[model samples]
Target: MMITMMKSYRGKLHLPMLAGVVCALAFLVLLYNERISFLSSTSFMRFNTCAARRAARDATDGGRAKIDDMEEEDKLEYDADICDITEGRWVYNRSIKPLYSDRSCPYLDRQVSCVKNGRPDSDYRYWQWQPDECSLPRFDPNRALRKLKGKRMLFVGDSLQRGQWQSFVCLVESIIPKDQKSMKRGRVHSVFRAKEYNATIEFYWAPFLVESNSDIRIVGDPRKRILKVDSIAKHAKNWLGVDFLLFNTYVWWMSGLKINSLWGSFANGEEGYEELDAPVAYRLGLKTWANWVDSTIDPNKTRVFFTTMSPTHMRPVEWNNKDGIKCSNETRPVKKRGHWGSGSDKRIMKVVGEVIGKMKVPITLLNVTQLSEYRVDAHTKVYTETGGKLLTDEQKADPLHHADCIHWCLPGVPDTWNQIFLAHL
Candidate 1:
């Protein structure tokens, strides 16, 4: 199973591989040049306890209990295929330092460079996700580069996806010789190149997955979002012929109770718009994306993966820290297993599962939500930037209003996400 992408590289569609090394990560890289496309959830506890719950509920009925016992028994069985990687806890391991420091990765975005942003503690980098049933392979850049040889891997959707994209780049970029590597930034798309392998790691910014007004990397009013829930071709055209596509979108859709959705083109001056409940709009948007996958992709040639919604830590009250201001000053992970925060919505996750379940294409879901929920301390908090600018000392001083609880600190949680991502490959 695999989950990710390369977008156009602006070369010809279906361009055969340039015939060298593979280095793409996340969404649409075209195979005509070998495009990689990156393409998620539940209370995990609710599923984990299914067998036990069945045993209890069926105890009174001997006939029903017998059948349920056999069926539910299958749920507890563990194989490499059935390993519940999401049902894990964060272990504080001081021995395991990050593969790349914020300083080492020149491409590290200011939004998640906590250490460079005057963060005093490095404890957050020490915790590793330990699966109760099996061990995760430690991240190896050389091996990962080999996995990506002659491939274009694409990471698509929102800034969190960008964080995961950045994590993958930082993990693999350090080893390539200076002359062999290059990074290019664009308004809607970006590519990190490794000439030695003829590989490209790329990212495309499509915040809502489907077309949206907030598709740009930076927006004037971030909260005033609008979606073209019925369309995707505007973005999906670049994803064509990608070998691996990794994708995600959720936080941006939850900005308010109602989301403004457009029916026509963004060129039509925002006409044919209507206000619908966020969930209704979300379902339509996902359906549009699903229609593209079912109609366009050939699963045998292109592996598609959708990362589950990344969790947030904005409300300290959700974790029982009544006095804490969001994730501010927090330096330790939440120890509770199956800890579901308010930041992660079960309803949205349900939509993801339902839509993916209905798709004819085989899309591997990188379920990182449950594991990340424990990393309450991993957010950039007040140390990160806003609107692409570093926060001032005065703004950082105000943790309550200024703390960024949505994005994870690099070399912190996103590295773990990439680890889970690598496991599938």
Candidate 2:
């Protein structure tokens, strides 16, 4: 009966399967005969057969040992020669989609929730950010929360940065129980605490990253924007000891109005205030910020990131639209490769690159500007609500009046920014 069973098994096995069985038995035999080297004298066919058999055995044995070996090999291979992940252009990938949904993420704020606020299209949510050389690992919020446990991640910048903060909060907040998370808001700062993980994700309003007239507890007007180019101590104090610090300052600098810099206190009036060129003023402000980071931050304990300027989709000419349509009603991204929209200023990006290059404490530049330039269809536009009411008909009619082409929608482009952020982390 046993012989009949063996013959039945042999008859059922294919040539490849027979080879694998022979290889498995040969491997066992060679285990005792250490002098016989299977790799040196064995033919290619025999070696591949043995490899296939070993793979099958490993798979059946749960593959933990084989996986550990491969992981160790990968560590050895990639530990010393990591590539620059952010220096890549965006590509269209149908297989990849947004990591979170606006409907599913309860932590999503109203202003940036473009889907829930009555936007009719879903195409914007399907676009993915693809790096040039390597693959960006999909965001796993549970893993992100695990890494963020007992740590603090802070985003400091203008409203664009605030939008990114909201996106990130929504991205990871779904994994935590409702009762374990809490939120607190202040004039310049808002904190989201995950009590279960002892983690806090916070946003600090520092449009210029320095003490400015616009730094008031409540900044209502962008027209009256003023920056203190030489002082950042007031805002920099709150940034110390953070595990991750993301800083951005751009749109406020590009308002085309000369910035006012104060050599004296605001209490002293405009006596020490001087008008400076925008880019020059921007350079000075960044220098002040860089100085503070260099002096205060410990490179070993903290990771610093400065996001590239977030593009605005205000001009139709920028996206080759001859009919003069803004980001209000667009439903698709720029289909061309290397589409350099007119919204981003290369001069400003140059300033950022130069300043960050000179920093002693390795600050990563999340160069998301080029990737964002194509996403003209992803802005909040007129579908957004202001003060708990939708835009009026007149407001919707005037593109320049109620259309917000500056800030992005939640579960949109900023999620890609955070996804890249997670891969690097």
Candidate 3:
């Protein structure tokens, strides 16, 4: 059976390879200069272009080029480049990391474009994606979302949770027949309804998915009391009977201070959270979240997904770039480094995996962290403005510290995130 399956797969590869070869030949003809040359100088441009398209396809399909065919050093070099963060390696699979490329996404066609100079730093703008315009082969969002209609999809976490929610929304909304779509915002939940699919996508902001001091209760004197973790049940109970529950909570816990007065404890006095360490706090929080999941969320009725931490590009030295410089103006999709593991902080990953390990429910993990760790350039601060009209000039200037270059550009990275979501769903 394995032999037969392998042959069947090999047979499948034949067509794409032949098609790629034909496309490569046509480009060679176009670059003939004066005439088609069989024995003349080489056309490096055509050669590289064909290689790029093929390489992108291979990587996107999760096929690392065969190493046995090349010399040891060359094989190693290719492996390194294909996974390079600076190269924006995720472009091969842009559905998960939308800002991986400045060029329009092949899946969505020209609907996604770079706003500022198509560099890495320019990665943070909206993609203007159109479902109808997308040319890439993909599982239909209408079909996937159809399964979720009338079902509540909740994103629970901190500000970064908003990023994934926005991404998931834009992706689903694009597929929804526009005439049938509607959105309604409430104090705790923001719902997007697609009449055509009968689906209601909602976002409920719970920085901590569990009940923590941050969500409820006041500490210190009333005059000086700062708002912190209050009540998780106030929000968590409302998300019951949900069809999809996407959870995230890292950046906010690490935010150290209040992210915004609205999402945090500003009024509560400075009896700050004693759980200062991110890992310990995360473990405890997940314990609470797990207790809730096991107690309330029914696995048969709801699909639960936990988004791994979204890495920030604030550190340039990690990517071999100079200090004070952010991920901006990077056109080429190649990383200077080879390994994704080298760039990420593994301690966090271990804690996350450990928490999930204890869960009785199967949690789908959107593990874009290591791969995203390298994409320090794909942020939107000081670039475009649509969703975030309230932030000031100063906020945009200090994106590394202020404006959220940490999140993701809507319609770009999030679209891919939705794609992954659909695949799992």
Each candidate's TM vs. the true structure?
0.82, 0.77, 0.62
lDDT of 2 by residue, 15-91 (tens): 43454557657655644643211111111112232455435545655674442232211221111013233324445
What shift in Å separates residue 203 of candidate 3 from its native position after superposition?
0.6
Q: Cα lDDT of all candidates, in order?
A: 0.76, 0.72, 0.50
Candidate 3 C-alpha lDDT tens digits along 147-253:
77667778876656666665555555655555878777655567777786667777777766654444433222323322233335566788787888888877655
TM-score of 2: 0.77
Ranking by lDDT: 1, 2, 3
Q: Candidate 1 residues 1-425, lDDT tens each?
A: 11101123454642112211121221124313312222112342222222433344345464365421233223322232334566556778898778999999999888899899989899999998766435677888998888888988999999899999999999999999999999999888899998888888899999898987777634556445668888899899988766789999999887788988888676566766789888889999999998999999998888888988888888888788999988997888887657888888888888887787778887778888888888888899988888679999999889889999999888988898788787768
What value does the lDDT take at residue 139 in candidate 3? 36
Summing lDDT over every window of 10 consecutive residues in candidate 1, give the lowest-scoring window.
19-28
- Model 1, runs deviating above 4 Å: 1-80, 217-223, 267-269
Deviation of model 2 at 154, angstroms: 0.8
RMSD of each: 13.0, 14.1, 14.2
lDDT of 2: 0.72
Better of 1 and 2 by TM-score: 1
